[model samples]
Target chain A: MTERKLIVSRRKLLRVGALGAGGLMLSGCDSLNRSEGFRSLLEGAEDLHKGFQRLGGEGALAREFAPSDMSPVFRANGNREIADSAYRQMLAGGFADWALKVDGLVEKPLVLPLAALQSLPQRQQITRHDCVEGWSAIGKWQGPQLSRILDMAGLKPQARYIVFHCADRFGSTPYYESIDLIDAFHPQTILAWRMNDALLPERHGAPIRLRVERQLGYKHAKFVMRIEARDSLAGLHGGKGGYWEDSGDYAWHAGI
Target chain B: MSEAVTSDHFKGGDFVRRHRLSTRIWHWINAVAVLVMLMSGLMIFNAHPRLYWGEYGANSDPAWFEIGSNADGQGLVKIGDATIETTGVLGVWTDSEGVVKKRAFPGWATIPSNYSLADARLWHLAFAWVLGLGVVTYLFWSLLNGHLWRDIRMSRAELHPKHVWHDISEHARLRFPTGAAALKYNILQKLAYSGVLLVLLPVVVVTGLAMSPGMDAWMPWITQVFGGRQSARSVHFLCAFGLVAFFLVHIAMVVLAGPINEVRSMITGNYRLPKDREEG
Candidate 1:
């Protein structure tokens, strides 16, 4: 009877020990998961994030620029041509006759020549061009703000995005870019005609290029031939609205 | 006979399986994400190699060092046909008069100049999204399933001064108790893991996002909280340091706590308990 009692006690002790260990394990897990301390920590972090967001506020404007700061040496960083022979011939003649057709979701659908664009109320801005490739250059750019041009063209109410179709090409694909309405009307957003004081060189988009100052270098579209107003970017190449956007996984909103 | 059957049924021994599948998945995922983040982060640090807290630079004229020389105080280099001893950036250079000149010590080594800043930014930002998503998902799933509470909660007894001292003394002596009790993590593990998950990771993410120019419009308060852009950057680096410390401790724990058994449990969700010779 004593032997049997001893065996029973040992079994009971083992079982009790296991239960105690298991309970501790479960408690430790609970502390990690639902403890007041951890919850407060998480809440504090989230509160900080929300508070920052609140302080910054939505639709805050980036700095605008004057024309004197455009870089004297503005170098093109990517491909420079539309592989078609006809386009090359047009380019050789200085593209004077080349008309920039502004259409699609615009009431006026105006086709303005480069000279006509030059004659328009011009804006010159000397601003810093920050590249995603980690370089910055201050340069003066001469052109009309896209907002004024769009206003003249009279964008339809349905128009939400301004797409820049360029003369450059990558393989069989023609280079194209687009920006939303916020950037579209931004004071710094201009279709630049001249770099520094001279007319833009062929390497620097020749007659015209874009200077979306608030964004990184890739957003600065070059070799402009047409400006199309669209309601959505869905039908565009890769549906992301820029050359690098399609080729590289570049964010559609390269705001920084 | 009925008692024997009942005891047999109770001894199934399956519930003590190592780590749950979810825990294992989260652990390994965090491991990979943290490693990639650290490597890329180190590359980015090369931009300003010296670290400083607050606004001061590294005391203007920073003390610097170079690597690759032996302790014999003799410089050594192999020429076309013979070995030459030289020091400094000029090394063993023949002057315009055909006289060989040796300077003392080579140029100071800078941080590793392997990556471009822009490329590093892109990689960091892109991978950041992955890490953020993983963390969020882990938190949500763990919360929903009650895993967090189950693993990290402590009892009043465990919180006692005696128990805490016992743990500390055992740790100091490197005396890890082996048994089912030891199979479960001690209090320190729970605290460190919780602190990292609930505190450090979120702080790093917030500071990083706060430093972005685009997010400035939406989250200016983050800048205010951290003092400024540079301050936020400093905090981000500090939080990253905390995470690295946690990672080192965690690895050490894994090594000490029967690496194979622990690793297999994480991978396969099963662990065989050490056989109890007393019962046998």
Candidate 2:
């Protein structure tokens, strides 16, 4: 009788412990997630990841793939087509009049048209684009290195970050992204005008898109209309560096 | 199930030191950290509930494994050519608020319990450091203190099939070691523990680093080792489920071996041996 009673109670205790602890923990985590302090504490890990990533050296390049490795169907994600009339007009006009505005914290502010951008020394590389949504696609991208454009404009010493103002928008908010000077000067960083040997399609950020090869897809702002050199990311939209970072709580440094 | 097996009714042969302080500390910390990482990782998986191979794969690409819902709202898990219906558990389930959710994993099994990939990543990344650092620290300490060789290493004789089969049969019959014999781990325990410490933990960490694009820049060959980033992701997922399988068996063994006593031994580092009896 004593043994049976002990067995029954132990079984009950185990059951209760498993169910109760699991339930309490799940609900407790949800509540803790809502707390600003707790969320910030968790976000603190971003700094550690960033610091460790920088230890790889600034000039280190992301692995590039062969042309044969390119995906047959490279999926276009986010803002496939800008609904704004100004952007639609430019698209309809074949982006002939479209000019990339280069200004802010620069000695010379210049507007380069599509032809001028194409005329610059071009580079083509096949690279894998990793998305934050857990997908990757390889494609050949052709464009001049971003460093060449920055050199053409002559960046000021105070300029610490390069911000890309895009034509796409989510509701009333315009899409934008920023990168540090190290990434800005990266050899692979380019304003890709062509993909997979064809003129860039509208669904895939036609005419031009910022391709920061080392980072996730969201950091590669599409429909890039203006490139501004800024000393800081603050005072920008939502005070975050990119659209997803601002609205979706994505980390501004999306190298991970 | 015997009354004497209860922690409170400890009429055992002797109370012996079964686990060291370092082992106990590492075990408890990992108990929380590993679960957090797994749950949050499931939430992250919910974002794209598909696994593939090679350096590149997206929506249009063929996936080797995927948890998805058809047009009829039936939840299905597909692995290669085989498909399993997993309604109400995965692919499709109702949340705590009584609303239907179309996610890969149930809310109860995920951190934050809602569809927030950002929040899930936060939880996953934060606990990753804890789990990663804990493995490193525990391994270093075990090496320094000779716990790795003294407690976990199996002798050449123990590695023999006959000795292993004997231990397995003993475990199958629930014939647990008694008296002084209970102080040391059998061959099975050593294998499981060593597998977790050396193989599973290290592979999981390395595969995780392989998925990071920034880390890819630092060590491009990491991804290449697994064929590609997506392959690394698949390996990471498999290893996580492998750990889960180990956890389930470990818990069942704890219950069968006397939960109160086993848990107390883990927590307090002291275990009371079962009294040995002569068979008639």
lDDT per residue, candidate 1, A155-205, as tens digits?
999999999998888877878889888778877688898888888776667
Fnat values, one per model, are 0.14, 0.80
Please give, for residues A202-226, the per-residue lDDT of candidate 2 as tens digits. 9888789989988889999888999
Estimate every model's Cα lDDT from 0 to 1. 0.63, 0.88
Task: Point out the worst 10-residue segment of candidate 2 chain B by lDDT.
Answer: B1-10
lDDT of 1 by residue, B139-240 (tens): 888788766776766778877889988998987776664445545557777678778878888788877775554564455576558764446666777798
DockQ, candidate 1, vs. native dimer: 0.09
- Give per-model TM-scores: 0.51, 0.93
Per-residue CA lDDT of candidate 2, range B46-76, in tens?
9999999988889899999999998888889
Q: Model 2, DockQ value?
A: 0.66
Q: Which residue runs of candidate 2 sit more than 4 Å off their true CA positions?
A: A1-20, B1-12, B277-280
In model 1, the runs with Cα more than 4 Å from the true position are A1-149, A156-178, A186-252, B1-15, B44-123, B154-166, B273-280
